[model samples]
Target chain A: MDNSVKLYLPTDAAHIQTLKPNTVVQIYGTLYTARDQAHKRIAQALKNGESLPFDLHTAAIYYCGPTPAPRGKAIGSCGPTTSGRMDAYTPLLIEHGLRVMIGKGVRNAQTVESIRSHGAVYLTAIGGAAALYQSRVTACELIAYPDLGCEAVCKLTVENFPAVVSVV
Target chain B: MKIVDSNKIRSDVAKLITECLITPDRAVTNALRRIDTDSELEAAAAALIVENNDIAERERAYCCQDTGQAVFFVKLGDGVQCVGLRDALDDAVRQAYAAARKSVADPLTRLNTRDNTPAVIETELVSGDTLEITYLAKGAGSENMSKLYMLTPADGVDGIVRSVVDAVERGGRNACPPLVVGVGIGGVTETACTLSKRALLRPVGVLNERADVAQLEKLLLAKINALGIGVAALGGRVTALAVNIEVAPTHIGMLPVAVNLQCHSLRHGTVKY
Candidate 1:
């Protein structure tokens, strides 16, 4: 069953709509990494009408806080954190045009509603497949909230990043 | 009295954490292999785990990003004395996090201490002269979904089963399935929680020595799989790989039941001295 759908970064609404829950999705291109602290900061910035470091429209954020990259590696072992932790901030982000999230776990009711209404997708990365996930990332760099260390927002370039469409 | 060098313990713990992060216990891998992969999701998920293990082992990389909070359960021997055992554990965790990921942080600040130090060390005195240390890289996903219930003696066996099944149902795929369900029964409130976590260290599919507890484990396992949550809740017959219940004597009036979960990739090991 290698009929996995391929999704390139900067994907449009039409591509996301084609994704149903449980569909295997392999992603290519840029995906941002953010977890609890970074999400909190992003939410606060949005609430204050402060321009975010990255635009929310067409943005796909992975709920992750990865370890530091070792020598000769693009990034450290990176996998999805529990998506539910970001549930409170998610509806707001979705309202602002955040189209996709990658993480483990189910979302809260409000977050699920937001995901449904916004035509966004919540994808499931195999929770403990850190080494495998890391191999998919070709490049990584810290972009915001460096002080948060691993919790800092990062920009990652990946290819064939496998995930299952979890919530829609 | 047997005097041990603290440095040896520090280095040993460091190695133990490093090994556990990449290579899960043999029972965990075996359980993962045995998952009936009838659903494509379960099969695919299982493949990812196997590939992840391959990558981790071949490249010396972490199998999961959330290397988890370093929790060490120590069984100290009466005849053996070590002055810096605690410090050695703390130092070992710091060394391990340096190579992998630093998951420990202040709860209030939610900021990384940079060095993942100050491991949670639980110690009990045992009869032997060898110090035994059990390590569990407790991930946040499953941990966040843990439940603790305070039921009266009236709740009985039914209550205990409900508490476990309910927690697994509530957690669903978020707690990460196919899961190893750890049910802690009959302890003071907090002890139940600890016992539940301790239950996870047991080898997969192994029954408790107590026959009744073993039966409860089997019953709970059947009920859990019947939930049809499956792997990643993708829908199938195997939601839980096993159910392990750890029990202790508690107050006559109150019955405390706590359910803790470990994701399919249960990272744990034991080092004895």
Candidate 2:
């Protein structure tokens, strides 16, 4: 298993290394953020044939709704929420050429199956390492759905953004 | 008739809530200490921890927006009868919620009905001159995954371990990982369940009175981590932060064990008056 890769947006899972169930990996790079509300909006946009605020192809999505940033910081302690909540929407994202997902919790059978079929990797983040994570986000900006508060879709620029890739 | 100061109770509860908001709890803080290497699990945990803190800070929110079913374990002191202890406690919760709501969002969703109640009170009268209240805000995720089992003597420790571990496994990614597992042993059926929940009140990494039980906690901790449940079950080595067991003497034929878990967003505060 490759020890590391720079995670990014718009990347296709099929193009990356073959991902088996429960393989571990370290991810570092820019990743798009989303959670319950944000995922719904993205899917809705896809359904309408409308261009999403950000491209899904070749992208990595972190399932999260981050709090506002501290003074002079890029972001607050941002942690991944539970992944099971997004199980229904993940396969669709995978179909759109999404390559990696960073979050916590187990995925539905179909979600894991989609990863295997699509060559996608799922990364596990420590569920409560909020403040420590904020240190890695070198840059951040709201890209869409600003009204969603913490759930608003945003773009995060990270460096050596550590994550364990588990294929389970 | 003994009289207790109701206002003191309100003040104490409010103070506890505020302090809890400002600082990340020990469970999260300790877990941060373990993220030494750049594994997928640590990175995932690091990434999510930032978000958790951000919500706690920027959102001006509770450490977990699921302020939870605020369950308070209150100990009433002897000779000190507090007028409206329950009402005053509830009022304190209400006030704290109002004071802190701007920063922390409520945990309710269109899918949920409990919405915004802060603390559920479990009062016990003890011999003392001061009131002691332990506030545990049971977050929605892990609380939902908590389980209770009535095992025959045959189920044994292995069975208990399996039940607890299986709960975490079946809970999968739902109960946020690096979970603080509270295992209650020996009590009768329902008492076992209550013990498990109360066991969560024990600080992370705290051990049992019995060396055997403490060893069991360590054993369970190792096995659960081996599950590769990782943070949020994305998969990794650190599926649980710690395993804490609280045991009681049980009926001759019963080996009841209850397992309750606190997710990464474990939040509890204490107040003494």
Candidate 3:
């Protein structure tokens, strides 16, 4: 439990593999936010032979749906959603070069195997720590799927975002 | 007779929702404080959860982003008269959600209601003139894992225990670990399910009145924790914080058991007027 690992987004597969399970890490740089609906859309697009909304290389996806920001705050109370819901679309994203995912809950066996095989790692954030996590978000902007409301895809700039490597 | 005003009730209800969201219940917070973790991973995770609650309170933010569906349990007094009770509660929910800027969407269409409304209201007419309302903002993660089973009489208490453990095992990380399991035994299918949910309204760590029922709760909790589900479904010593059981008389031939899993956030509160 060193708890000192600092990872930059778009990290390489080799780097991800070196991280052990339960290793606490502070992630820096850009992290894309997507939940069940956005994942479905991406999976469907790939099925139809279309490009994804953002390049997956070295990208990290966070399963979250934040409340509306009151006024001057960078974001509202933001925390991880259940990752199990995204188990169906995860392997596909990993195969397409997804290197990191931040969420809570257990992943299905297939998703775990995909993470290990595809050089991806799944990280768990403290599930209910919405305010603490939101405090780390420096900025947030809607990236895609505006119609999904809180479930929309957004790019979040975070500093020292806390998470534990669950599977690598 | 207590003549309650609709407007007053609406405002009070709205404020109650906000209060419950911003502040974690004392009983739940105390339970988290008492969690003794076996592994460093669990310890770190537990620390973060405790810190999160403090931050949420100081910053007036939600403990979890998924503010959850609005569920209300109301006990109306016979001598209390408030016109348009349902509409007032609905209006309160709408206003509260808008004020908090939380999301509530249509289940099928995924369309945001803009304001959370049409709260699930369960009402009971009691004896006194005081109106008691309990609010539970149930997150979808745990709510999705809730189950109901209609067992034959032969299943007995052992059967009930096995089914409860099975539900927790299958729920695993999906429902969030270190959970509060609400068990409802007896009654028919729907009654069993409602009883299970109502069971959750009880304060965490409190036991049933009947000695046998209390013993059953202890047994179920110990067995569930033995599964080693831990916090956030990672490996640890504690899987469930408490198991609260509520039973209702039912047909002799049927044994209906419903298990409702609640996450660590346990956002619920009560206000009496």
Off by over 4 Å in 1: none
lDDT of 3 by residue, B1-273 (tens): 998888888899889889888887767666667778768777777777788888889888888887888999999999999898899989989888885544667779877777777788998899989998889998888988889988989999989999999999998577766788999998889788888888988887789999999999999999999898787777788788889999999898999999999988888888888
- Model 2: CA > 4 A from native: A1-4, A12-15, A18-32, A37-55, A68-75, A138-149, A155-160, B21-70, B83-116, B153-158, B172-178, B186-190, B204-206, B210-241, B248-256, B263-266
Best candidate according to TM-score: 1
Better of 2 and 3 by TM-score: 3
lDDT of 2 by residue, A20-106 (tens): 444444455678889887888887777788888877765678887665565677875576677778887888877876767888666
Find the 10 residues in a row with the least total lDDT in model 3 chain B. B98-107
What's the lDDT for all of these models? 0.86, 0.70, 0.86
Clash tally, candidates in order: 1, 52, 1
Tens digits of per-residue lDDT, candidate 2, B163-268, equal: 9888887884678777888888886876777788888777776788789999999999988888876765655677787888889999989888888888867677
| Cα lDDT tens digits for candidate 1, B1-273 | 888788999999899999998886666666667667678788888767777878888988888888888999999999999999999999999998887677777889776778887798889898868899999998888888899999999999999888889999998678767788888888698899899999998888789999999999999999999888877666777788889999999999999999998886688888888
The TM-score of candidate 1 is 0.97
Error of 2 at A8 (Å): 3.7
Model 3 chain A: lowest-lDDT 10 consecutive positions: A1-10
- What candidate 3 gets wrong by more than 4 Å, as runs, is B99-102
lDDT of 1 by residue, A1-168 (tens): 267888898787888898887889889988999998889999999999998978889678998888779899999999888899899899999988899889987888999989988888888888878889999999998889888888888999999899988887
